[model samples]
Target chain A: MSYIAWIISIGNELLIGKTVNTNAAWLARKLTLLGYDVRRIITVPDNEEDEVEVFRDAIKRGVRVVISTGGLGPTFDDKTSEYLAKALNRKYVINDEALKLVIETFKLKGLELTEPRLKQAKMPEGAKPLPNPVGTAPGIWVEEDNTIIIALPGVPAEMMGIFENYVEPKLREIGPKLHFIERSITVKGVPEADLAPIIEKGMKMSNRVYIKSHPKGHEIRSPLVEIHVYVSSEDVRKAEDEINKVLDFLIFAVKEKGGEVLST
Target chain B: MSYIAWIISIGNELLIGKTVNTNAAWLARKLTLLGYDVRRIITVPDNEEDEVEVFRDAIKRGVRVVISTGGLGPTFDDKTSEYLAKALNRKYVINDEALKLVIETFKLKGLELTEPRLKQAKMPEGAKPLPNPVGTAPGIWVEEDNTIIIALPGVPAEMMGIFENYVEPKLREIGPKLHFIERSITVKGVPEADLAPIIEKGMKMSNRVYIKSHPKGHEIRSPLVEIHVYVSSEDVRKAEDEINKVLDFLIFAVKEKGGEVLST
Candidate 1:
């Protein structure tokens, strides 16, 4: 069976359009590459009630892993840890491991461990701390009702650092491993509508693969449309072969239309 | 009262990391500038049941406006229009206005109205067709259960064309209008941790203003940490004043910290 994951991006900046939410895309890509199916990405504000509701709802929706970014900072608006505890009906307390991470990070940065900073250590009972090397906030990882909840800091750099150093390895050990192979061909000058027939025909070449065309731009300086072919399976070789078959047909169609493949 | 919106971006490519979901960010920015709160941005695959569930659930959550982008093509995977109809319990039919748009678009492109292409006219009953000037698939606009559900084509150019030319004007007539004033102050040669104190102090200048510092990088060549100051109010001047007060203190602090404000 395949593993399903969901992302909940918690930040008012995202809802207000102050931030573009590059974190969801980054997490989705990482999870997908690691053989997990990232099914849904939901962005909510930093409100405590809404955060608790969304986090609980994701679990109710039957996702195996749920990752939330943002709302892990020292500011007043950051309340993911507190809300998450309430969502799962767990006790909220200052975990010593998480507190150590908070204290060490502040010491390394030559900053005092203020009360606001110390609040980052308060997490749900029985949750493990995912150390944040680049920032003061420590991420939380808890498993409940057969669902794994992972919360990362909102800052993109800190989020990426914690995921790469801690979460990725942990997920690799526990999450399902499926093989995914994707290929792309860049075609210039042909609009997506005009290539609909060719794309349809290319898709008929492989039932195990999906072929999608993304229109980049039609401007004179950037006349390129990218066709992506994706295949995933339990067997790496089968996935690779399926993707290759779809890509071969797509590349041939692009070349037949007098278009150039910028990348293979 | 401000109107809340939710975006449902349907496509496996977005989940698989093949696409960056620029449409959600674009729509969120537009709605926020026009005085709407985009509470949730959800990304799901092109599955019919999943789409229906998400659409129905968003309305249940009390968002007045729900917009979905993608899966409006003539391809096999294009099922958003059909699923949206099921979600609202509306009958599916070939809308006359939508059919005209599909025929005219294909006629102009010198393409035949093939059976698959004709499917673009199938829309929910009683829904108004938002003409797609850029593509064959026309967008659908429907009012159901006190919520407005809009479905746009997946292609960025086509989605944008319909949103700007049609839906935007219609929304202006119905959706709430809130003024959002956002100002930016970029400081060089200072880390976010070092500037957190100043940011906290600047925030006290105005309770109506919000100041967020985003660390770009710490290296000498890329030492720009952008501080965004935001204010939203019914009065345009009030919003402007609030943002300016926070930005003034922020800029002065940056200068005192041996940094520069590259932008106001």
Candidate 2:
């Protein structure tokens, strides 16, 4: 199973630069660590048309999982659930389970639910509501054919809470069981431009392992670069050994080019 | 003159959770402040097929300007310039100006140019190379019909240098001349759910001004919210006055709802 995923972050704030979209990065890290190939991280505005377009685009690409954050609030601009339903050609209605969760949450705070509060319970029909232990709006989880669609609140705490509590477990069950291994080493005294050919040779030699170099110092003087070596395989020991062998080869090659390995 | 812009960040490191995409956020902020309506921020791997597909999609969407970062280096994985040429149906060739820039940069450091270093000079036909003051790769700039396409190196310093020194001036000449004004006021003792109706009312009252509420405190207990009021208009005074009026109304309405304004 190819366990591919896409993160669709919906918010005008993100588009306008009011927010830095730490949410997307956080979710990307989590999905990658879970052995899913997170292929795209997309951000669009809160507009319903843009939201629907991005969602449909993800579906057309045939990714295994689609996760969206933001716009699941109570304001008029909060339209992720409704637009997602539109994109899926499903009915947008208040889920009874979601309503119950909202009522219980508000009741615990000694408050009564209102129309604005009721908006938190609305979701696409036939979707299951993931309980938000830290916030009011319940997260949405629905499966279409082979893809799993999820919507979480924009609040970092709420998004993290629901993701860790519900989404992680479900994803683990559906995703491929692959072991991922990675290692990084910093090299100095060699410019990244000069190190490129060696990296190319290393990648060609070990097709199973991926080697990426990040330039850390000035290209002209005091050159520094961080090379990341990683691989994934069905066998844990095989993945680990492959990465180690690639690292060894790359380290030896860098030394041969008069580059100093600063740290690993 | 809608001034629509899109930011494309290319890297596998971003997808694999090895690096955070701070470049996209920084560019989004710059574009927004320059009066460009940044519609989307897309991140993809270093794969050529993905890069070509995204570039074609952006062109098809008819955005005014498309700025892409990363994959403009010398490594095998760095294919942004070549794929962008293919997407535009232009020849991928070495430009004389870019080659001169690369040669001069290396010469200043008392170093000799090699094939890997020469790779940084290749760009699409009819594209102008924006000199990279900090790195080897010269940024690519090309125009097709009504859209402008640009590609910059992934290193933050190099990207920023080329953008600020070259791209910013060109963009300023083409973008809309609009003044943007924004203000934020934090309110405590009010849950975001309860504040939603007031936000809705405020938006209706001042449709020209955009009012967004960010939940700062927990939804149920010790509730705090930051209301951001902003507007953009051709007239600087008009934009400022409009946002201030909305802020005043929102503040007064919050107080009426028993919410205390903490900071502005």
Candidate 3:
């Protein structure tokens, strides 16, 4: 991928460990599959000042796309949309389409539409509405400097439902065509230190391959370390070839080090 | 807590969804108990440029403490210590104590001490070594500009071992004395919009209480929304009293709104 993507998970629950930031992980996987090199996942608390600073900095850092989840509810604390509006220097307005979505969602739930409920419809000016089928709040999609910023609800079901149904189609249409392939090998008795030089050699041999090692000492997985090699390209065959070459080299290196290569 | 802390979870596995960042959640909870306002969790790939830029920016932002997990292994990709050294403009040097610990760990494991393994002992100049009892790599703890930067192993067992044994005690010794209390009430049939006004009133009525609402629409959880009221103070009694006040108000308001209050 030519550009880097980012994920911002906004909520106090995340900071407090009351809620795990699974939204960031899930989005990262989807974006990577779609060929965006996801650079960072920033989990900020539900505060306007912090959100605004982080969001603005992300854009300033030349992030091509940023998918933010949380703080879309109709409470005083849920200010992610508002903070994003300020960050983008856009007015917080009641988008007609988003208002329609909120009204429709409440009707479907047979719930009352109070004045505060209308706050759910407020989004940054010029943002496209991403409708949520599973919840009341509608997501916002804004584009500035050719950078796509998507703001989605915090609730897991609602966030996933909107991202898959509405956001995924938009991304597929605009995102560059790319495919990624990955292969991993687990090596027991070999530390990453011993495996580093061989992995470095593999990196020099391959053009697009990215190799990483995750060490797990003595807990459950018998392997002391796992080496993952990934490659992305427009052609599926090219990606597969690049990843496989690195994986093969690492496996052989593990064998030479007197380590058991667990995964084929 | 008076100071803001952050977590930087490194490694490409986290970004690719091959690994879920349970370490960040675990650290956040631990720091919260240590009386720190855990602010952000940044998950970055194992690239030096990315790591240096992020680590520098975080320090520039004046985070009181930064706890980073992953990338403390003995691999070419493990560059957290090197990046932190560059970020702080300090020389990366091999700490004698850390080298001793690494050599001892290898001896205990009956593993060969390769030259590549020696890289694990290198740390930012003037940083203290937090020994890892469960793994080879010793954690690096550096204090710069009054900001405490801690670099721990990516491996779950090693990371937890260092944090609990060494980092935890240090934080406890230096961190301010404070205690927090949280009381949450689940309300069915009331959307966040309807609860917002009451929550705003509760906020005004208390000095230390912080109220937040989590919406879960038609999920396995029975309640549609859970409003959490939290308070922190040096005095445990003050925190308890403040949380109880908000909890009482929320319960009454939910009842008035014709919503079932699930918690006592």
Judged by lDDT, which candidate is best? Answer: 2
True contacts kept of each: 0.41, 0.70, 0.66
Model 3 TM-score (2 dp): 0.95
Best by TM-score: 2
TM-scores for every predicted model: 0.90, 0.98, 0.95
In the range B150-187, model 3's lDDT, one tens digit per residue, is 99988878888999999999898888777767778878
Off-target runs (Cα >4 Å) in candidate 2 are none
DockQ of 1: 0.41
Displacement of residue B236 (Cα, Å) in model 3 is 0.2
lDDT of 2 at B103: 88
lDDT of 1 by residue, A1-264 (tens): 448999999887787776787889899999988888989999998787789988898778778889999887665667899999999999999999998887777676566776777788999999999987776688899998878999998778889999999999988888676677887787887656556778888778777788777767742234577778787677888788777777777778777877777887
How close is chain B to the truth by TM-score, in each candidate?
0.93, 0.97, 0.93
Model 2 compared with the native: what TM-score? 0.98
Model number with the top DockQ: 2
Candidate numbers sorted by lDDT from highest down: 2, 3, 1
Clashing pairs in 3: B70-B154
